[model samples]
Target: MSRLLSSLRDGKGFDIVLVAVPLAFLLVFSGLPLIYNVVMSFQAVDMFSLGTFNRPWVGFKNYVDVFSLPATWPIMRNTVIFVVCSIAGQFVIGFALALFFARGFPGSSYIRGLFLASWVMPGLVVGAMWNWILAGDFGVLNYALRSLGIISENIFWASNPAWSLWAVIVANIWLGISFNMILLSVGLAAIPRDLYEAAALDGANGLQKFWTITLPMMRSTIGAVISLGLIFTLQQFDLFASITSGGPANSSNVAQYWAWEMSFRQYDFAKGATISVVMIAVVMIASVIYVRSTRHEVRG
Candidate 1:
């Protein structure tokens, strides 16, 4: 049995070699960081003790403090709002854009290119551009609105806590459509033209065709898009942080930003690690449900 096992390992040597570089990287970085964070979460270490060779062990205290935070519920709520609004809005806008492009009208290729450009742009760059566009004193958005007599004065833009959250949401919506449009375009392309022809012959209008044929036929694609979007949004940090830095008054604080603040800004590594662990658990639980529901095969 030992010899057989050794032979089996030898048989997989090439596969192991193929993944050796990535496996080594994951070990040195991802695995080590994850293990270290988990360990940190169980210990009690202050900023002064950060470099000390000796660290105190205080099981679950970090976690307890994490859950005990006054901002925890609000931050979690903001995270939910950010995830749901960003993903759902992006999905709808992307689907609509995909449908419009599918018509193959004039300049459709250019429009697709525009969507691709947004997708390719870095999130931080997008956020920085938005900060200018939404700037209070000299924002193009408020300028145009004022010129059109939509309002007498420029709004606070991102100054107010409530409005700042929406500002971030708006920025999210703008960038999010790219993912949906790109994915849905392929799904739209994969759909057979004959189905549309048959539906047209049956006196079905475009809306009817889309509802009865396009949507159902593209369920798997839609599921895949939603799943990826959910995963990305759940851990989203860059745009949110760059846009508001967790906000004018902490109103826009999401779980990601909170974790960053705890770990980096507050210099509380143990509590930060605890928050990271909790965030991982939440994401994993949600992803499990999402993956199970979106499974391709469901027949009993």
Candidate 2:
């Protein structure tokens, strides 16, 4: 029995300890908050009333309010549209940029800092910078557009509801391309050159090689990058909040900003919790599909 204990406490036990740390954090922070939020969503949590101790038990009334409100549908619809368009745009743009970066350039190392600098900047800062660039009157973009005969002298980028969504989407796409480029670049680098060479010998041109060899080889990496990007973009708040404040007449309001409005601006904790819960469910559903499709390995 003592000899058995000694062996258990060596290599196997060391691995066990390593796994335990993340598990402990997941339970304390991620797991507990998820459970608590679910509970809170079901209750009548008043921002102002009996402190945290005594609140009425309201089962799904908050959810009902969330569903029934006229404003809610628009926000939700907007979120869906934003998420879909942004995801599609990012996939296309990022994939192209990744391919570009994979072909090493004379100054690719220096250029990476220039291209990915926007991504590494704080979200709020990115929002502010993009806001200025996309602004109607004095924006550099407008100036260039006018100079190049794209739009007259004055064009409302965020003013029209039709264009406002696209404007925000463009920003999100720009932000997304960097990470995707970085990951796909790494994936491309990790590929055994022999595979490409063999494909070339077998009459596979550049297009054929990419479709058959590069994409299939990088499937897991691409999946992880795209899925995580969707999650982050779906929960986007800082950019919308900072640049538009869900504004130009609620046109830019996403699920996260709507929840922010409920909790922080409107001082309605119950509604906020309700929105938070729903948003969480949306993210989790995406995550589930991602996991199922990608077969992501569960890391201990």
Candidate 3:
């Protein structure tokens, strides 16, 4: 016992045990559930046999049925639009903020830290806040637009099919901005000051320096950011649940929300699992990109 304790305290055993614990935890909790979800996707699951794993296997049937649904394509399109617009908005705005703060102006760090308040807030809370702001009448957003003379009347953002997805996208972008900004700030900080100094000596202008120096150094970080954004965007369900609930003829519906609606609301566990499996595959792809990006990081 003493020898084992000694090894654990000051030897390779400590490192092995340190790594093993989280691996074991992940396998039991995360890995097991993920594997079960994939398995359930291929099975003909009913409430009667849900408690056991002996349900009849009906491979691809759930996938077929999900695709055959009339709302599938429209929901998928909304999902695509949501992901694209949210990531674009978050990245552009976040990058701009990061660069601005990187200038080291007065209280930049303090101000940047404050921005994380929005990101740290629970998604449900953010959704609820946005919901109030997006109310058709007397909402802050509509009031602002009206005050600015941008529109003639109030727009029902969460109810109108034309604007429902966009409403969620706008909220999602705000929620994600801080995360993108912080990560990009770290990336920008990691870049050596000497590079910029050298570029300045070479008579490079601001745009040329950014395009030639900052972008190259930030390649890996940008990849990691974009991959994580994809994974998080795909996993976004809480905002939809709290704000729209995939309502108004499913205009704002996405895969994750639809999966929950299927499993809980519709009691179609197989189809829900099928959707989850598809999502898992997508997340895995993003994970691969993140891993590769980190592997190729240009350390300063």
Residue lDDT tens for model 3, 140-244: 999999999999999999999888888999999999999999999999999999999999999999999899999999999999999999999999988999888
**Best candidate, TM-score:** 3
Greater-lDDT candidate between 1 and 3: 3
Q: Give a tens-digit lDDT track for model 1, residues 22-51.
A: 999999998898888888889886688777
Candidate 1 TM-score over all chains jointly:
0.87
Predicted candidate 2 versus true structure: per-residue lDDT over 1-300, tens digit per residue: 776568667765666567889999999999998887788778887667426767778998989988999998898888988898888888778788878877888988678657788778888888888889888888888999889998866767777776787788888888877777776677788789999999989998999998998888887777777778779887788888767778787898888889889887887877888999988887897797678646742330
Instruction: Show model 2 residue runs off by greater than 4 Å.
Output: 1-29, 289-300
* Better candidate by lDDT, 1 or 2: 1
Q: Residue pairs in steric clash, candidate 1?
A: none
Runs in model 1 deviating more than 4 A are 1-15, 285-300
Cα miss at 18, model 1 (Å)?
1.7
lDDT of each: 0.83, 0.81, 0.92
Q: What global local distance difference test value does model 1 have? A: 0.83
